[model samples]
Target: MINISQCYSTGTIKGVSKVGGLIGFCSNTTITDCYSIGNLEESPGWENAGYAREYLFRYFGGLIGTTSLGVITNCYSCGKVADVPYAGYTQYEYHGFMGPSEYGDENTVASLYFDVSKAGRTDNFAVAKSTQEMKQQNTFIGWDFIGIWRIGGGVNEGYPYLLFSYTPSEGLNVFIITDIGLKQVTEMYLITDMGLKKASQSNIIADTGLK
Candidate 1:
């Protein structure tokens, strides 16, 4: 069994058949303390977008797709899980927590929650909670608060973050430029114990010595 914990996804993942926001397919797996803040769309491609037709089976889950011989605990998804509006003979098996749990004897999923307003379905597969409930710590039972995770203060905004990123001192400053390319001839400033150092790199990874 595969054990997954303290992981999250914030980007859109689109696909069909055993598709999920966290894992596309799962069997004999155990997932805990995970979340997805991205949209999970099934059959994203257009019917006539160079393809003949969409897949006949579209099984999608907010956190995990088709679960068989698996266990999911203390996981949540705040993303939309549904099939795109496409005119075709496409089948859908979408769920808030997981796609149809086929083998009830082998698969066990508990404490799975989703945003009621965001997620369209409120089936027994996963519990539905309000947006306010998601932000509160008490809402999630058996979650690690001291060692593994922390919340608030714009880290994950209202969500919890991994403890490795926690800092008691001043936080590190990060800046990004979308237009910049590798070896594009640009200057950079780095902070060192000595002082602010101005340097440039022929390659992004190579050091150019302190100045």
Candidate 2:
């Protein structure tokens, strides 16, 4: 398990088998405001007893190798990850933020952003910005935004939205608005499973609006 906050990593792995930036194998960790730039590759190794020799299983990833349960927020990754030349079936997967292999894993973002323009090149990994203020602010364009989900550029086509499954007994019941524009507006509605309720002007608007 690994917990990273505000960091960056990059490089190339020539013959390494299992490789990753933030983590090779993760479990129950939290990563925030981080970035990864690199190319992770698998080298030729001893073939497993049951596995075939022709197909090499290479594990290469950007943010993580395998995540069972964890939380990743406000992070991004730009790199070329290739799992080849190994002695098994290769699974090549990349993420601008994180790589999750199981359910119940939480990936959250509030004013987070990512640029994967060079994802398939150079094997670069970097955290360009560490603070939430670095993201370009805009209005929420009506979409799902929540926990254990991904929201940002590249995958979501630059449309920010929360993604996650619902679990009632987790924590406090609070509505969170991520858009800076939405937080600036005065009139808004509190949406819930039951119905929509008008939010107080003071509640929706920030302190600057109050003045």
Off by over 4 Å in 1: 46-57, 83-92, 102-105, 165-211
TM-score of 1: 0.68
List the candidates' TM-scores in order: 0.68, 0.42
lDDT of each residue in 22-58, candidate 2, tens digit only: 5666667776655555655555454543555432333
Q: What are the runs in model 2 whose C-alpha is more than 4 Å off?
A: 14-18, 44-59, 83-97, 102-117, 121-211
- Predicted structure 2: lDDT: 0.45
For residues 1-211, write the lDDT of model 1, one tens digit per residue.
7888878888888875677888887778888878887887755454545644435335677777777788788788888777445434223466766776655446777877888667675545678888777766677676766666555445554665566655533332222323211111234666667788764443223454322
Clash count list over all predictions: 0, 18
User: What C-alpha lDDT do the candidate models reach, one value each?
Assistant: 0.65, 0.45
* 10 residues in a row with least lDDT, candidate 2: 164-173
